[model samples]
Target: MPTGTPLAASRSTTERHDMTPSDPGARRAGADTTLVRHLNRRTVLTTLRSHPDITLSTLGSLTGLSRATLSAVLEELTERGLLEEHAPATGGSGRPARRYAFRATAGYVLGLHFTPNQVRAVVTDLEGQVVARERTEVPPSVPAPERLARARALAETATSQAGPVWSVGVATTGVVGPEGRVLRSSQIAGWTGLDLVGTVRGWYGRDAVAGNDGTLAALGEKWQGAARYADDVALILSGRPSGQGIVLGGRAHHGRSGAAAELGRLLQDQTWNAAAVLDEAGRTAQDVFRAASEGEEEASRLAAHLAHHTARAASVLVSVLDPQLVVIAGELTVGGRPFLEAVRLQLETMCINVPAVVLSELGDDAVPLGAARLALDALEEKEYALEG
Candidate 1:
């Protein structure tokens, strides 16, 4: 588990509003009531966001809050214009029920995705809809300073058109620890042991959060792409160095050091040279898939080789943490049907349970949309938390 902000980094498994009388509960209750109230407001907001038309009565039941306590928090949030109450439902029962929902336009969020060859940015309203998007080629030899400058410039460009940037979320290809620290990376050359979050905050001076690219991609797929409503899942990104994000019990499992499910650096061959693989541009994993698709015999054999290695890697994942779905993204799987067909066949032969494998439906926007979800999820406004 992460350690920082109570809500984003570490919140108990149960909803925050529920007051449990346990050893941990004693410590929590002994703290400031204001903090608990704030958490309760956020809890209410998340609950309402998930069920848009939830009645006040249902809200209390879901969050395990008493009438008076729920009313107080609801009143505060509504007064702040973060939540809005709707007219009671009429014509169904003897007494109608009053419901509430998040005010979708209460604020704006910015999402940025940093790929090896490109940087994508998007601005979205509170509801996580992409209002604007831009992508730029990353410099060939992307030094850390240059990448930081590019991220800052791109974020400024995107936020310039939005009303106001409430929060910013950045996704990168690496082992990013909680509090936005990069533990390591096999793809981006100089990103290892870097303080990505601090650098971005220094550059933009905005409330920002950074995460592993695949984690954000999975979140985006759950929000606006494929895997919507999926619980146990993995997101596979096929780039120069592929990666996977693990989602268990409907949430990303950010491990103790924040590098729990990083699959890219899973060393398949100790002698495999990263530079040599990148030099043979035609030898990219995607190119191999394309060749096979075009009926080239060599391409077919190499594609099978790639599939076998990939399946073996996936088999490791299944043996440890079995997921329900695996979504393939990036140029490799963008071939859609054929790519999925071959990969699925290969994976089924290796795994214990045959997980549903599919190509990313979010197209090129998968990472950017994922950044958007991360941004919204980090909002101070409580209601945004409720989104499934």
Candidate 2:
């Protein structure tokens, strides 16, 4: 689990709302209180997320729940193994208080990221710690069905040795439509019009979800990377399909058709995807970036070409959204400041308002971690069924 302020250290999950306990003398006990009880449970669980070793008093304070109601919620959670109690600790002079923490190991989630050149899968606990991982390299010529089968096999194998998995999330290279359907994927042959969400669900026979890689990476960055504090952000991932994802007001901004950031077709001729350039040069992005940073002319020229196109698209997005920040992900991050400066310089000329552009700290893990975050959403928000 990440050691920082709860979830996004700089943000709060649920605001402290005044909540009153139910009347004990009600005639109908189980009829009316079921939904309320469930809500209270969710509140406690959400409050404890990434916030550990909290005493009852503090939990009550943060949640604004009455002591009696808070105690009942904690007892229910402890009974369900979602929380664990720690030994009593003496603090400032009152009686010792028993602390409780959310048990991240209560259940697990599977996340998979797929690009034209590679497939990566990870099984992470509820707190986003990778417990198992699998990867494979595939030529772009591989058929879509074959690639799907390989993805299924890798995902199944990755989760075999881990704890019980509650749900699965997939990040793929394409314009994802409603219900995880691939609206279009020109880079990978025969990949368009696939029912990705249903396909992944068949693999696990449980809850599954799918989304565009760049879009999910945006969510991942907000959850753990550079945009945690930014109210609005735009992210460009220079991987296969070279698309963008937008975050507005701390939530993903998927347009009506889930194609808000599908800029691959427009970018294909202008900006060569970073991996394709690196692969043809027979060099890694890191190697190219390092040489460019040292003032190598050839490397610097190639890096500038990539930066120019990235900035063009970013400039358009900045003009429209006027976001507070912009993030560069995937191979482009290795170029660091030189690449960013080039992009920023170009952006300044094209657009009057330019936000601060930075490299993604989550690196290759961004998509997968974001997929895990998606799976968690399935468990907590959508279906609201994590059984355990």
Candidate 3:
């Protein structure tokens, strides 16, 4: 599991209220007791989610909620089936304090990712544990409509086995519009100007959310991969064509047009296209890496050349963004430590202040997990709105 501050921790703090006697009347006039109760409920629930199997007394100490208020909130949550209480061990003398925990199975969220060749879906419980997953491959020659349908079908199949999906998040390759449409995609055939979110919602019969695959991949790293400890990061996904995702102040930075970090576009050299580079050398990217591993001189030179170009591109981002860490993701990482060392070597020479560079631990699953993380955020928003 990723080891930074959990996403739920930052959101769990209660909003402070003034209790000065001079402003008592004004505060009372502006205050809604119902809103206060909801806030208290959210605080308690979020706290319990982070620290499971905690006694009520411990929760009271952590939240500073009076016993009366804490009891009321816990009771309400328990009644709503959002929390569960378990009895303590019998060895304790007379009576044991009961422990309360978040009911992870209370709801589910769906995460879907669509690429030129495949559609992947994952269903996660409220606590972000995978409950079910499905994947389907679509030939590159398939029409956009058919590809979209297959993706939707895969999502539906995953959701059906995972129970009620409270929220859905979709990640795809392209410049995603504010309204969740794919504005353009060079890799996917006839994918430009498609209403991706609308297609998912239309098929699933519920509102669904969407984001760029690169950005989501960065979020996934934060949530469960190599960048877990870094607040500011740049995730460079290397493949046929590379892409980048930026995280600043512990949040994904989607630029004004949601196309903030299109690193592949910055490269004017042929090295940017892995397929083209491999074709020229009469070897696949994987084959090149394998041969280089076996000490083949030609393959070693090719790997070094690709690393230099990648480092050149990455140095520009590092110089401008100054992120604490840079994560190399996608197909290039298949080369393993040798590829990472080569990139790091070039980066150290080019960069004035070189940040730590490492390979992505999540591989292809990063985007889908990041989408699930987004779905969890959406679920929290919906819950808050309902309570308010």
For each candidate, the alpha-carbon lDDT, in order, equals: 0.70, 0.78, 0.79
Clashes of 2: 0
Residues 280-332, candidate 3, lDDT per residue (tens digit)? 88887798899989999999998888788778777877999999999988878
Clashing pairs in 3: none
- Each candidate: how many clashes? 2, 0, 0
Point out the higher-scoring one by TM-score: 1 or 3.
Answer: 3
Off by over 4 Å in 3: 1-31, 205-207, 279-282, 385-387
Tens digits of per-residue lDDT for model 1, 1-388: 2111222222233344565556588546545444675568777877977999788889989999999989887766655556777899888967888888977665677788887777889888777767788778886478877887787788788877765566778888887889888888766768888887787766545567888887777777777777886887788766544566767776666778778666545755722322234355457666666777889998777656555555555566666877788887765664457657777888777776877887788877877787777766666544324321
**Of the pair 2 and 3, which is ahead by TM-score?**
3
Say which candidate scores most in lDDT: 3
Clashes of 3: 0
State the lDDT of candidate 2 residue by residue for 95-196, as single tens digits.
Answer: 889899998886688889988888888788888888987899877889989999999889879888686667888888878886888898876768899988
Model 3 residue 49 CA deviation in Å: 1.8
Indicate the worst ten consecutive residues by lDDT in candidate 1: 1-10
Candidate 3 residue 326 Cα shift, in angstroms, is 0.7
Measure candidate 2: CA RMSD: 7.1
- How many Å off is the CA of 378 in candidate 1? 3.4
Candidate order, TM-score descending: 3, 2, 1
lDDT of 2: 0.78
